[model samples]
Target: MISQLTHLNWFSVLCAFIPYFILGGLWFTVFFGNPYKTSLGKGNETLPNSPIFIAGPAICCLIITITTAMLIYALNVNTLSGALEFAMVAGIGYLVTNTVNIAINPNIPRPIFYSVISGTYHLVGITIVCIIIVAMK
Candidate 1:
């Protein structure tokens, strides 16, 4: 594990992290702002402009990027095909499922709608992350 960490390309991880984080910003705000708000039952009401909203997701994306990097190194995934396969597995299995699970609650008025929006964001984000990591490798 330690050896794999040393072998991991830190630069590639950063490169991957940037786009994933950016995608989340765009996904939640620019692209699906109204839909997202509606899903939360906010319906045009301004959501809290708390720093935690940004900081929390940034932290999560960073952790995800680092973990993906480690897994790519440890699993010896070197090809584009391998990266895509890994992305699909990780994206759908972990990210999409978790997003859906979180959305299926009383807080979200439109749980399925919220899940579709958030889950797809994560799926695409993970795909980008995996592709960047593998290409840079």
Candidate 2:
């Protein structure tokens, strides 16, 4: 499988991954910033300025993007339609299901709201990445 890595278009993968970083910034700051804070009941708390906080999610986003790209290659999803459908199914089947499991746990606050927002974010993000990768490839 290691040799199979060459089959993937790395530049396309990079292009696909970039939007997640951009969307995340807009989603958590410009677009849903206030709403997300309100949902978390952290309306008064300032956004964390620590490098760890910033870098952590950035790293996670990279990982997620890389994983998505790998999956696309592994599944032989090259067509635009296949990429879109596969990405959506993967998002719902994997990401949303896993998130829902965690969100529904009693320990998680605002379980429903949190799941809706975060899950949707993953779905949208994955879809965007898939479209870019397929189109570019």
Tens digit per residue, CA lDDT, model 2, 1-137: 45546777888778877788788778888887776776666767877778886678778777777777777777778898898898889899988888787888656567777778778888898899888877876
| C-alpha lDDT of candidate 1 relative to the true structure | 0.94
lDDT of 2 at 84: 80
Model 1 misplaced stretches (Cα beyond 4 Å)? none
lDDT of 1 by residue, 1-137 (tens): 65777888899999999999999999999999999999899977998899999999999999999898888888989999999999999999999999999999888899999999999999999999999999999
Per-candidate clashes come to: 0, 0
Worst 10 residues of 2 by lDDT: 1-10
- The collision pairs in model 1 are none
